[model samples]
Target: MTVILLAGGLGSRMYPLTRIVPKPMVPLAGKPILEHIVDYLNTRGFKEIVIAARYLGEQIVRYFSNHPHAKPVLLDSKDTADAVRLLGNYIRDHFIVAMGDVICNADYSEIYGYHLSANPAATIALKQVENPLPYGVVYLDENMDVALFVEKPVSLEAYLLSLAYYRRRSTSAYENLVNAGIYVFNPYVLEVLERNPGLMDFGRHVFPYLVENGFKVKGYVLSHRVYWSDIGRIDTYKSVMWDLLDGKIAGIKPPATEVSPGVYIHPSSDVRGEIRPPVYIGREVRVKEGAVVGPYAVLEDGVVVEEGSRMVESIVWHGTIVGRDSVIYDSIVMNNVKISRETRVYSSIIGTRRIVSGELRNSIMEPVEVVSPYAQSA
Candidate 1:
């Protein structure tokens, strides 16, 4: 089956991070988020992948163009409608479509199988959310078919109550299922997309056209409760990390968290720590320590923990150094950051190649330190 990934947005919500990088290029765990999706698709036995791109689309082009399994389509068009129209020209058959920003936990195989068998003009993946007001909500029929779609509503209680009612389909007044940004569709859906070029939304535009025209659009309830999140803001980004740290999501077996008895290390890393499973080291990374590493901390690759430094709940990036007796707590240190001895850094993000050789600093990167947080602090 052909899987289409929409990677066109400018990702305005993911500022600071997205300022220098595209959303999909933003790193998660250790690698870029886009790479993870590709791996997910490959694992589910899907080979043909297409990415729709814009806004520094070259990054997307540059990435997949080099990869073996990635087949990309660059769309330097206006809004969502034009992008979809462009894709329709190529995806003339049934295909799977997903948003580049929506990170998911469920496998594509089951979703694809259901779409094939159901033979609906479109199959919409549904997930019940506690807060549905911020997103598009699709109302389903008793037969688990889509009846109507709603964009973000201004009314709050009506929205929440709608979701509450929709969640319990058997006794509810209506069946409300928020789209999980996953869709499966036949070529006919593409025709709708092309004709309604002015309607720039799938939920607000094409799907409603299906309903108004009496097309068979089915809604499949997602069975697995997986870790699904959109990494668009700093808070959401923090939430993703916290979720990974807590092992809340199943499908994403984070690297291999084997922090020794008193250690806390990430799974994909190698560490020689004083304490034994509580240590968190990131992918292809290493840590050598007479240093007290982590009861809880993350070290990205090429990070060095020099002798006798203390760190907890802190994140250090590739090539950063934690100098001897340098105490870092609840902070993020970027790549190539060098901390001189006996300095104390807490609750801060130090930029890359920044030199810190002072007494104590709170949430501040050194100025002549030559490290700018935008570039230095990855």
Candidate 2:
């Protein structure tokens, strides 16, 4: 079975960090997010995989070459559906489609088997999240078929009123079952996509069209043990990082060796500081004497923590240097950043390769490319 991974989005929400790197290339647990997905798919017995990428897709292509199991399809268009539509010829009868930015613990083998047995035109993986306003809520009938799809209503009250007016009012009970950005679809669904050239997203267009046209679209509720999250926003990214360190997220292991109880230090690093548990120090990292790191800190490869500095609940990226007497707490420092001595950084997202010398708290510091007002829109 072929797996289609959509990685073509601009990822404006994760800007500055994603200004030079694509969303899939964003690091999670010391590896690219897409690498974990590929590892997950490989373990599930799915061999052939194709990635549809645009908007700095070259980084992805360069990172993973044309291997037998993994192939890259650099698209001219940025639309998700268009990327999938371009690969329609490669898909034989059925295919697995997933968003690149999402990380989930759903069992692909079981989901694929369920789809094959039910023989539906499309099968969407659904998960019940606390907040349904930000997602497209799916209403499943008694037979587990998709009865209706609501694409993120402006207000929850409006959605409830519309739901109360529907013929199958009881379907509101399943309002929390939002789309998980994962799907198993037959060639017929792709045919439906081909008919509408402007259709761009599965939740916004394809899934709704399938239900409206009387096509059978089923929903598969994931098991409770499964974990799912979208690392699109800065807060979510930081949360996911801490989750990984705390062992809250399964199947994502940091590449560092556990030196002490919860302290993981890479073999190539030079450390002489005090490192608390639940810390991950990557390769070639330098921790000078009198520096205190840890209790949820991650220093990626080539990072330098100078003397008398303290870091806690922070993620410092590759090649970044923290000077003497500096303190960082509850923050995310992007790649190649340099912090001068006596600086204090907390609760912020510092962009790639920036130089910081002052005390910044409860603020966002993005790179030059993401500082302009038009950067978010672009």
Candidate 3:
């Protein structure tokens, strides 16, 4: 089956980092989140993959092309409906389509199986989250069919978010299944998508149409216990990386990137330094000595933690530099960033190329918005 991965979001919440790479390419557990996603799909014998991208779409295409495994396809477009419709038109059979930005350990085998067995126009992978307001919530029927759909309700009450909890919601109200951004679609559904290219999301658009227009759409609540975190924000990115750095979750078995006696780097990396361990680094990276890299932190590849700089509990991404003697703690440095000497950073996301000198105290260094006790960006 072919899988269409939606990787088109601007990743506004994951700026700087997203500024350099698509969210699907974001680092997670010492590997690109997309890699993990692909690995999962590959394990299921699904080799043909399509990534629907917009921002930095070529990067995703390039990264996959260089590395051989599953042959991945990239589509850079603004319309999700058109992407899916095109994909559906190409694959004239039942197929899987998933989110390109999902950061989870969910397995698609069962979800895919139920979809085929039920033979519906579409089969949605769902979960009911405690706070259903921020997600595409749904209600399921007794026959495991979706009866209602709600896209991100702003309710504070716990909605018990899980594909399983949909047992109650899908049977009771508006959204029967909480969308997990995974779906199985039959070729017959292509006309629906083709007719409605303006639809924002599959859950919000196509599924509702199917339900209202007498289309058979079902829900398969995945019964697996896996760690899934959406790393679309600085906080989430930091948390997911920390879990990998600390061995908190077992998602994809990451490629070996460790070199030094104690350091643990990603397989897709290049480093030239005597680094210490308890560190997590991303793919296609570089590192230099006197850089005192990590005891409990990470350095995403293409990242340059220059001499005399010390990074702890911080995530520095591609094309970034932490200058000499600069101390960074509990911070996230985005791509294309530059940090000067003797600077102190903590608890913030430093945007791309924010010049720094002196000391910074709890700040999100935006584009050219320096935080050091020095002159500002011109």
Candidate 4:
């Protein structure tokens, strides 16, 4: 089957990071999330894959080209709908369209089967989440046919009241499912999209239009316990990373090879520091004496943690040098960064090639050459 991965949007939520690479190209457990997505699709019997990429899309194109797996078609487009439209002749009779940032382990085959059995214009994968306020909720009838769709209700009370207007049970909002950002579409649906050129989005326009026009659109509720995470923002990105470290996200396993209980150190690295459990030290990493790497820390290739430094619940990317006596906690240090001695960092994001030294709490340091206390004071 053909799968269209919508990866075009500039990941504004993940700013400085996306400034370096696209959202899909963001590393999760040392592998680009887009690579993970491709692996997931490949296993599901998807022969042909198409990536809809625009902002910093060249990176994605280069990454896959160099790696050489499915060799997916990279369609440069501004919108998802336009991307689909651009695939004029390539559009198959049945296909899947999914968001690139979503890390979900749903059975695509089952959803495809459900679509074929129900014979609807479209079948959207739905998941039951506790708080559906942030997402577009899908109301399904007894037969699993979508009854009403509410796009991100303001509050729980508002959602309940909206349900009450349609005579649907108030409790339905709590028990109802939300769109999982996964869709199965037929060729006819493309014609509908072509006719409705004004319809920019699938959630805000196409699905609503289909529902209004009495088009049979079904909801496939994922029955099994599946791991699903929308890694859109900084918090969610960290969450996915933590989950990968903890081995929470199914299907995609972390590249952590533990030499001791909860302590993973790459063979190529030289570690002399006291490392606590649940730590990952990548290749060519150097943790000097008197340094404490711990609790939950991930140091990528070429990372150097100097003496007297302490890191906890932090992720240090490639070529970063943690200077002596630096304390990094609950932060993400990107590629080629330098943290000067005695610097204290907490809950911050140090971008690529940055040089930070000072007491920074909840700070976001971009890719600057130097960001020291003296530099800022002067």
Q: For candidate 2, list the clashing residue pairs, or say none.
A: none
- Candidate 1 vs candidate 4: which has greater TM-score? 4
Model 1 lDDT tens row, 1-378: 678888887888765445445677665555567777877777778788888888767767766786677787788767665676787656657898888877787867888889889899989888877766667787777787887666666787776676566555543244445788888988777777666667676777777877889899988777647657777775676566656556665655445454444333555556664642344576556556677766557676667777777887776766677778778887767667788988888777666567887765556553233322224232
Which digits, one per residue and each the tens of the lDDT, describe model 2 over residues 61-167?
A: 87767555788888886477778888887899788999888888788888999999999999999998877667767888888998888776777888766655552
Candidate achieving higher lDDT, 1 or 2: 2
The lDDT values for all models are 0.69, 0.82, 0.68, 0.80
lDDT of 4 by residue, 202-244 (tens): 8888899999999999888876498888888988988787777
lDDT per residue (tens digit) for residues 1-378 in model 3? 777887777888877556556777776644578878888777767777776666666666666665555445566555666677655545767778777777666667777888888899988877645555556666777787777765554444434344345444444443433577788888877767667677656766778888988888887775446666666677777777766666555545545555554367777676665565678776666666666767767776567766677887777755677777788988877656778878888887777667777777777666563221111210
Question: Using Cα atoms with residue i matched to residue i, what is each candidate's TM-score against the true structure?
Answer: 0.80, 0.92, 0.80, 0.89
Misplaced by over 4 Å in model 3 are 66-76, 153-177, 197-200, 257-263, 266-278, 282-296, 302-308, 367-378
Write the candidate numbers in order of decreasing lDDT: 2, 4, 1, 3
Output the worst ten-in-a-row residue range by lDDT, candidate 4.
369-378
Among all candidates shown, the one with the greatest lDDT: 2
Off by over 4 Å in 2: 66-68, 154-157, 163-168, 171-175, 368-378
